[model samples]
Target chain A: MSEVLVIVPVYNEAASVLRSTLEGLRPLNHDILLVDDGSSDPVPELVSDLATTVVRHTLNLGQGAALQTGMEYARREGYRFAVHFDADGQHPPEAVDALLDEMQRGEADVVFGSRFIRADNRALIPSFRRGILILGKVFNGLSTGVWMTDAHIGLRAMNRRAIQCINLRENRMAYATELLWQLRHHGLSWKEIPVAVVYTAYSRRKGQSSWNALRIATDILLRLIYR
Target chain B: MTPIQLLLFAALGAIALIYLKLVRYQLGAVVLLGLVLLTGCIAVYAPDLTTLVANRLGVERGTDLLLYTTVIFLCGIFAVVYGRFRKIEEEHTVLFREISLLQEQVRRGGAAT
Candidate 1:
């Protein structure tokens, strides 16, 4: 098995069951890295009981900044590959094994867990955000030259080579755009696997709005023009 | 001439002179001087027509001239402030990026040693 490190970026998801989520991933022989992005609650201390390396951001940087910190940590620790896990508990632990299995098969450098790859049912998603996701797919295809059914799924696994090439300077939701563009620019091999999404009320609250999505799209356009 | 009419002519003369001096051309000062002399001749010879036109154009006293000058000055100030703010934001972003790079180097160095 490859030396895998799972990186979870957490904000103020104090009400979510983080410990149970960590417990669920205990079977995988991977080092867990929990990045506390300046949460106001006592989440760091609570997560201290779990067997994971906890990194704290001095200030509340966005999700992109937290992910960059974790990725850098993984690289410095000499890990062969790293997985991006969401702290909001939308991703199931079982899906992580599938992602790792795909990685082990050497099919691609990065594997994204797509919610609509083969699934016919999506009862968990609200109609408004579903429309937003569809819009995201079109924007992603235009920006990255890759036709993905879902573009904003957080569950993904990447090898060290792929991580090193991604320059995630956009510290907010634009990180997703930056990642897809980096993959396209570096010509990195990638694949998408079907995975189920569990949308809780908390996840919906933290989800991107149509206005924020437009801003991200604009930022992506600017990056393509300037960089 | 009435005090209001005198003020109105003086204000118009000032605005035209200032606009020409700052934005139009250096030679505009000579043009403004000739126009002011011409206006003085009109005021002395055809005072009634000048006053009637000024009242009809709603240039009561020098209120219109004062309002126009104030608006232009405010717009120029706003442009300068916005430019400075954009410059500072760019500087902060560059500095933050450099610091992150340095931090990454330190982390790598520590691991290597």
Candidate 2:
């Protein structure tokens, strides 16, 4: 089995920092890399105290930069795969094994924990957010022609090869769209599995607005047109 | 020229100036300018409707209406510039935080060895 490294990017998530996330992953033998993106609290020191390896960014450089920092570290440390996990408690640590299983079975080069998958776990999502996600799926399907059921799911695993091939340049949240576009552009093999998304008030606040979705669509269109 | 026609021309000129100066969305501004030009053409060529509306509104000339619109458009431009300033300030705050972190890291590294 390939060594698994979980990359969690955190901003000012002091409330849920080391307690739930570190405790949840304590059982797993995989290496955990926490990128503290210029958090105001002393998250670096707190996370360092835990068994997990911690990387600190002097200032908040957005999620894309933090993910890149973690991925680059994983690549350097010679991990077989790196999983992008949210700092928020929405993504369950238990689902980590399922993702790894899919990767190990050679089912996918990249596996997304899709909330929209027609599985028993679909009921866990809120209806309002589900509608937004369904719209996003349609947009991604039309834009990339990949028929992806979910485009914005944060829980995803990428092997070393896939990570190395995709060069993410966007510094903001739009990086998610860029990643999908890169995957499509390079003709990469990927799959999606149903996973429960726990939506807390904190996660809800972090969620993108409808206006932001339109902006992201416009940005993607412009990028495709220019490129 | 009737008061309505004069006001219409002034409004067009003011809007054109504001569009050239303030708005970032060029496509939207061009469309707006096109509409303004079309309205001005109608006021000049179709005098009966223009005069009737102006008389009902109690405005002396179309030029006066155009002047007021110009003032509003200039105010809109000012608002756009103000918004750009705020965005720049937020970006600077993020940059400053990053710099402070780098400086602290360097100081710690120097002391460790």
| Best candidate (score: DockQ) | 2
Off by over 4 Å in 1: A121-123, B1-113
Give candidate 1's iRMS in Å, 1 decimal: 5.4
Per-residue lDDT of A50-169 in model 2, one digit per residue for the tens?
766667777787787678777776766678899999877788898888888998898788888888776656777777767777787788777777777777887899887887777665
Worst 10 residues of 2 chain B by lDDT: B93-102
lDDT of 1 by residue, B1-113 (tens): 67776776777678766866675576666675576567655754556666576677777644454455469968977867765664564455445444554554665478679
CAPRI quality of model 1: incorrect
As for candidate 2, its clashing pairs are B3-B61, B3-B62, B4-B62, B6-B62, B6-B63, B7-B62, B7-B63, B8-B62, B11-B66
What TM-score does candidate 2 reach?
A: 0.65
lDDT, candidate 2, at A107 = 72
RMSD of each: 8.8, 8.2
Give the DockQ (C-alpha) for candidate 2.
0.08
